[model samples]
Target: MRRPHPASRPAPQLRIKPPRQLIAESGADLEGHGLRRTMGLFQLVCFGVGAIVGTGIFVGLSDSVAKAGPAVVLSFALAAVTCVFTAFSFAELGGAIPVSGSSYSFAYATLGERTAFLVGWCLLLEYGVSVSAVAVGWSQYLNELLNSLVGWQLPDALSAGPGDGGVVNLPAVVVILLAATLLVRGVRESARATAAMAVLKIGILLLFLAIAFTAFQAGHLSPFATHGAGGVTAGASLAFFSYIGFDAITTAGEEVKNPRKNVPIAIMICIGLVTLLYCAVAVAAIGGLGADAVGDKPAALSLIVNQVTDSTVGGGVIAFGAVVAIASVVLAVMYGQTRILMSMSRDGLVPRVFERVSPKTATPAVNTWIVALVFAVPAAFASLDAVVNLTTIGTLAVMAVVNVAVVALRRSEPELKRSFRVPLYPASPILGVGFCLYLMYGTGWATWLQFAAFLVVGSLVYACYGRSRSRLVAPAAPGA
Candidate 1:
């Protein structure tokens, strides 16, 4: 018998059922010199490290130190443990799907269209708000570095967002625009830039940790749990958001070579490395400067370095690192946002404009710039705390959903090949979900209100645009 042409076979059983032309169209959009599958485990690991290590270690550390004292080390442990379990679930789904949109796409493929839309909406909140928050933090460092080096500073009104007294945050907007421009160019450039920035920031952290550890004293840790267990949990919840980017390593599923093996390894390895770095830095900073003092100085790392070495060089180095690190964080997070939009557009959950890739770059250029403006404008003037609080809630909610997805997929597709599996089956994912929910509860009433409001907005979007535009809504789905 004559061998059948590749196109003659039905699409994979697990494949999204749309027209063959639609499938081809979607595949074609991803082809060529765009954000193609050029990244391997190393590049992907750097992506995770770049995105996760920056804001958390730099700006957020002081608050965690204040809340838990030296016991912030324990808080890091708690957050890491929680993430590891979720990482396993992410690894399984990421490998099984190997598609764009990360969890949003996974949910759509397995959970259904409506849940997918909700996830996408939550992700928009998660990524968009996070970029705003991180960029604001970056602006602070940029302002500081400029003042120290040139004896000049941007006006407070100009440097911060609306609540911070500025009508608009000019620096945050500039950085967001810069990142958007890079993303629209190509993925390889974006990934390479991320890797370089990750190295500079992590190196600065190591320098600080090494210097601070030398001054570590046992007495500073005396009141390890001064505020008691409640404080530690509260601190853990706040710190939990700092670790948000660990899962970004898995987002490169389609691009990672041998994704099953490489993605899981990269996820676990990056998490372990980042956790160690965070715990060590927390311990050293608390031991040397005292937790209360660190909190008062939001730019604690730079302040501590200046005091320790009695020189501007140390502070300058960290400030430089902060600028690069936060920029990388914005890039990675924004990249994740565009990919989700790309998937949604293809699925007809968002406008077709989001699905259209520029032939020049093979990237969702239009979608990325649109999202950048949407996020950057608010970020320029908004308070960092507000953006962070909202993002934390959305991220934790999605992690909980992912934990459930892991167990459901295990049972529902028992024989399906998975590159990675949660080591302890139901218990691991259950514990992961539990930890995430507990943290979500700790985000306070205000955060919950913000999250609820966003969810309501999401529902309305789904009712209006998503449901009507959804590919599945058509009797025979058309190519996007």
Candidate 2:
């Protein structure tokens, strides 16, 4: 056969990491690249709960209520339904792949290196911005707790960001730094601390529910759909932030024992537990105090508790719980951010510095510190509402990509070992993608523009750095 001219030949296809190769590399004991597997089912579940049950319920609930009124309960339900679909996709992929990169790794195996890089980039926004948003919420609750205990609170100028009439949010920065410190010490220690805090915070929320229910009034639920379907959809977009952490369980795939089995189980359990608590809390808060009263109030849960019981003690307890709850979120989500970067670094998609694991701590010390410092700047100066919306949109986009990836993998790797599978296969993953898109649509156009800008920057980074340096990319000819 005649040789084809180089100019006439088709261009090379996008690089892909074989699923089998990814599996083997994940299992190999590569020096300086290994993450210790210390988490069991209980620890993993705790990590998920720690990440899931925080600012969204304690602080952001008011925002959702403002948009949807008493029907914010329906908003929570809508968001939970979206999450359930995505969670099914995540569970199937996490079990099949069992890698720390989460959706990014799944994309690399099924889609292509370029698609995987974008997914990873989107995750950076999802996780890093989420930490900042959660930290800001923590500051609000911290201020509430301080007032309850000492009859004093931080000035608005000190406790809030520039967009919220504050020059800087000092407490937000402090909490993020504290979480970074714990992460640097080690993952096992962090998981134990998170588990304890997770249990305590759950008890505290239950207490709020118990006390608030005593004052429940059916009349408060009148005119539930204040803003109608549009409001509920918008509220659902914001409420989606509450469920961000369930997939954080998947990000710990490399650090969990029997990951293929444990990761999926933890995810399902976490989602069910979190959704139930969130819906119940929403009902209790709205029932105790009308939606108009709760909407837009800082530390709204604490205020509701105080009003319902005519005492500051209940409010103080809830404030303290919010502080602990939001702190755990910062810790757990930041951990996920560092792990995702570590996986990208290993694939030569990001700088090698991020891949460094401390010998003494078995943690990505440098990566953790860098992420904390970078994200803390936003926590200090950026508006909470802006970051929350941005994070939600980015997360939804990433989840949509994961849903598509699951379908792609099934088609391409039919015989691959999977510890768990999406119940409805094609239909389930298809619905997952549709739900993610629907929620993303509910976000404001400003966020879409911001996301577009982010993707542009990411494309440039991959073009100039990641694409050339990626491990799967073949080297150029010496004299080409």
Candidate 3:
């Protein structure tokens, strides 16, 4: 056979989705394939808030406090800074692309299809497992509320997971199913419910601040940096989990009205509001009760409120608020997971069932149910401690990818019309990636191993299934 000249051969092509195509497809109503745009700025902001203000503040605070003492406030600030950098990247790409896949779409547009599939895989860990973790936290507060109001609570056999000496976490399973039901109804209905819950939870946190501050003592903060810089950094790693939901805002790009403008603005607003609230709550909790008392206590805020006011009524109110707060997180995060899967399915990276939208609801009804049931098993039997670190590491890994995607997109498509831009260009995104790695470093080695194992499975699945089925490689079949 005659050898062909190297220069005459064609360059290998990469499977990258065009940014314009993503935007155009988002607006097209393809029979049962399109999602309705019903959320305005307020609803979008509420959705972000609902997702961001859950178990981290309500239950995980104790773990942070145990590590950093009074300096947990600094930990919150550190995590906020990390999120701010990534949120800027998300805002820019979300405005330009405005698709349902969030970081997965960003990756597909800037990086190649294989990278996008991996990013989507990480998101499954982030949103789906986080829902289970938050549900477990919700069960804790539910018990607190029940005991406070009725002087009775579910027994250990019914209230906790197997890891926690219970047969199943019934409340966790029930809450997840309820959230799935609400999501199947429609985005508008879910938005309204989330908004109402957002307002109620915010008010409850404010009330906690008021009562907690009444007992605030400077003496409580005397030894602020008790465990030093390493402790604060580790606490910040855990605190990063609290900021996970802000990016969930980008996941709603296809379902938000005027997403190009509203998505970016809502992201900025959500981050600023949630950051302030988190720092304030951290300060109030530490100041009201000395660091020693706050450490390693489950439902720390409610417990602090009870102690500060010397009454169970105050604690009960906060507990009830926590139950509401955590439930909203489950709803919002589950919604995000379904949308990401829907986007992946449309690209043929996953099963087609995920992409199917219900004609009557304008929602991925079957997909939502599948997500709920899949995660409910873990919520029923897995321990909260077992899932929290996995979720945090997965979330950090996904955010790092998004930051890299921002830099890549800027270089590849400088002319891309962006409604919002990262302030420092490459520097902002570079720092975002750095911060993510820094936090990931602070996590335990066991978590890194788990994340690594997850990636291996994801890569294998992509090689065996997604790679061959991807639409970029071959057009979808008729009616598919």
Indicate which candidate wins on lDDT: 3
TM-score of 2: 0.96
Off by over 4 Å in 1: 1-35, 475-480
Task: Kindly list the per-residue Cα lDDT of model 3 for residues 29-82, writing each as its tens digit.
Answer: 222147877889999999999998999999999889898989999999999999
Tens digits of per-residue lDDT for model 2, 1-480: 998999999998868897777767666223214688888899999999999999999999999999999999899999998899899999999999888888889899999998999999999877888899999999999989999999999999999998999999999999999999999999899999999999999999999999999999999999889899999999999899988878888889888888889988999999899889999999998899989988968688999999988988889999999999999999999999998998898788999889888989999999999999999999999888888888899999999999999999998899998999999778988998898899899998999999999999999999999988887765324432
Model 1's C-alpha root-mean-square deviation from the true structure amounts to 6.9
What clash pairs does model 2 have?
none
Question: Candidate 2, overall lDDT?
Answer: 0.90
Q: What is the lDDT of residue 264 in candidate 1?
A: 76
TM-score of each: 0.92, 0.96, 0.97
lDDT of each: 0.78, 0.90, 0.91
lDDT of 1 by residue, 109-220 (tens): 5666677788888887667778888888889888778866886889988898768777678899999999999988888888899888888878888998988887788888
Rank by TM-score, highest first. 3, 2, 1
Scored by lDDT, model 3 comes in at 0.91
Q: Between candidates 1 and 2, which one is better according to lDDT?
A: 2
